[model samples]
Target chain A: MATIETPKSQYGQIADLLISRIQDGTYPPGSSLPSEDKLADALKVSRVTINRAVGLLRLSGYVKVKRGSGTIVRTLPVILRDAKARYAARMQGTGAGEVEARQHNLVSNTVYRQIAEVPAPEHVAQTLDLKPGDPTLLRSRTLFANNEPTQIADSYIPAAIAKLSPELRNENAGPGGSYGRLSDIGHGPARFTEDVTVRMPTEQEQQILELEAAQPVFQIWHVAFDAKNKPVEVAKHVMPGHLWQLHYGWDE
Target chain B: MATIETPKSQYGQIADLLISRIQDGTYPPGSSLPSEDKLADALKVSRVTINRAVGLLRLSGYVKVKRGSGTIVRTLPVILRDAKARYAARMQGTGAGEVEARQHNLVSNTVYRQIAEVPAPEHVAQTLDLKPGDPTLLRSRTLFANNEPTQIADSYIPAAIAKLSPELRNENAGPGGSYGRLSDIGHGPARFTEDVTVRMPTEQEQQILELEAAQPVFQIWHVAFDAKNKPVEVAKHVMPGHLWQLHYGWDE
Candidate 1:
């Protein structure tokens, strides 16, 4: 009987080589990788090892394998949230999506926009200290990164405050977005709290983001408070997990 | 014609009531909730509304609705990471699992432990400043929180330093754990960098974590540096995404 080589180390090495190639742009995003037989022969490894390596790449969100279509490199758009930039003096004046677009040299567009007056949902009411069913202005938009739908944000603002600022009701909330309009109305955000969680995308979310069934989504619930520590705005953002990675850093 | 109410608001209200019930312990973990007909009659909502509400809860990881079985409340084991506690003086002395157990008032156990000398994988090698295939000590453990598997951690240390400290090889590192033993041997951690991402679990990972097919996992790669800023240890932790929520906070 032949002795079997350790699978962990061998497969890990193969995966590393493939990842390096992917990182160096040898196989750019949307480009298909070589077949398993070709990789196994070139690397002098068994087909099983090649399969395992590809599997590792799939699990790492580096590549997507399709039945009868071969494997393709994944396009990963990272969103680096520098702790300093997030709370920067200037950033406090603009929306996060606008800042992300400027940093990445990409165009940010509002694909879908809807401004409506509706009953506040329970969570939103609690966050904004409004009675349930109270009238609130709902500004819903689908934000596009480089013309691709990347995130959906739904912002809720008190009807009294929103009605005072006509710009807040427009599709484009001027240059600095809602915060800029809020500042003009003496309700600028002084503090923010964000809660993040990950889960499988809902059917509606998958359709909006055009994601595969297996893809997950990141949900961020953000509440902005005024100088008095009273909540002024609450926004919920849903982003495709496979296409986005959030970066956070802090000094010890 | 009698007007039909909008489904969105009605369903959302129903879901909110159900979530409130779940939160207040009206329906405890692992206990089945009432059927759709019963819920609709009691809550004065349509059956369609109940179905949609239950579906929302299922997607949010609040309850699990099996095919043949009814919907049951999910047991959410929260591991809250306070910013101050994470960087606390004493936490710097112990393992993350130990600190998590203490904070949550739950018992933590090391269910699996293995210490081996193996060739360093490429990523581990790069982080540890070692050549690929260099000898390294791999310490693997599966941690359980209150008798339930919570996380799998794999730590790699240079073989040279690991050989100098015998306590590092033991299943239970005395006192403050591996860092303490490393300090005794002249290699204590000073700084750390952690990168976190989420993805679908592999077959092996699913089995180890005992997760469902749709469940995702969070991967945290940590590199620890010494006083000289040289990497001394690299660790990878895999936690169930549905069971964990990472918290980060900072003041401007």
Candidate 2:
């Protein structure tokens, strides 16, 4: 390959060169790139310029640096935007005619419902106004986009309402998923609010999510309300932090 | 101190003893406990049992075990619960009181307006509905509880609304803190949501938060809504992960 003499001021251009190489598999995830000195010499740029370019990549989450260890390429997770506008924009560009954002790229879907006998967690019980360990339906599913796990969601519904929805027992549901199933049963959630937090992965989660030891997982705890302005269902979603982008719109 | 007798269930007793010592500050945070054999003999327990107990603690995040190295006591981070009913329950009887749960104990609070103009990142721009380079108000605070560092939150608001709130200028207007201030100004947030994730700490965050290299931080992104159903503020909070106990609630 011909060595390109990139300009010192063109840090972005140099960073793009590395990104392209990684995309082409020239430097696979977890692989180390050439030393800064070597790269600077090869690119015919001062090491300081090369350092600045690498700094940008680090901030952008492209590569990771270790004090004694060399810089290593990072694996970018499958990112899904949480903003509705962004979702609509992406969906519009898809060739499929009005496909559900989830089903359009469905990797795996599951629905499990019991007699709602599982004890409610302290947090869940208080929110639902039930005694701790109250019976509730625990429905969970893992979603994958392009063969990569994107999100895992666990939802709990009070037995009173879940029992009313026989359709929920059906094995195959449409793109509407749980939210739709609840609506079909006449307990549609009119609004939802979520509390989000992020933290480093536990050993098991790190292994299951195929994430780096340092990669954190995002947690979204959502509570949906019914028409009477009553809380109905609570759901928890966990995903690799880098994989999802959250967005919202507000009036000035 | 008188050594407790070696109970028939030696491992459990051993684990309990060590945990008590750690909690009471004998094995204070970041300090290493005695070796397996030393601890086992001191507590008259078998090495196997001692190892198992340590393993459990590591899993529960009470301690960090290094390969070929000793186990170190982990510092617990104070958890900021979601804005919900469950928070009230957990914090009760903790001696901090109910309103204490309403706000993180403020350690350092400062407000600055137009201190500097910086481009909004892609995600921030979308949430605030501003061009990428539009100016925004950046509010930063460090929270403390039990006289120890708890969490650090940085909020970015549209420059326009921020200018309207004198609290931002005076530094002490809202009773419930910034959230309270929003409501006092008729922008009382009716609905709020947050997304949380956890991962390894950045070297800088770890140092600033006085966290060890082995520990991680939790990052939470929150958005508050006003009566007009508009997003009035978007804030990012980062805390040491070990001490937090996240809570959420929903009504059935």
Give residue A86's error in model 1 in angstroms.
Answer: 4.7
TM-score (all chains, Cα) for each model: 0.68, 0.56
Each prediction's Cα lDDT score? 0.74, 0.60
Error of 2 at A244 (Å): 3.3
Candidate 2 per-residue lDDT, tens place, A6-87, comes to: 2334665687788798889998977888999999999998888788778656644567775576888875443434433332
lDDT of 1 at B45: 81
The docking category that best describes candidate 2 is: incorrect
For this target, which candidate reaches the highest DockQ against the unseen true structure? 1
- In candidate 1, the residue pairs with backbone N, CA or C atoms under 3 Å apart (3 or more residues apart, or in different chains) clash, namely none
Q: Number of clashing residue pairs in every model? A: 0, 28
User: Clashes in candidate 1: how many?
Assistant: 0
Tell me how candidate 2 scores on lDDT: 0.60
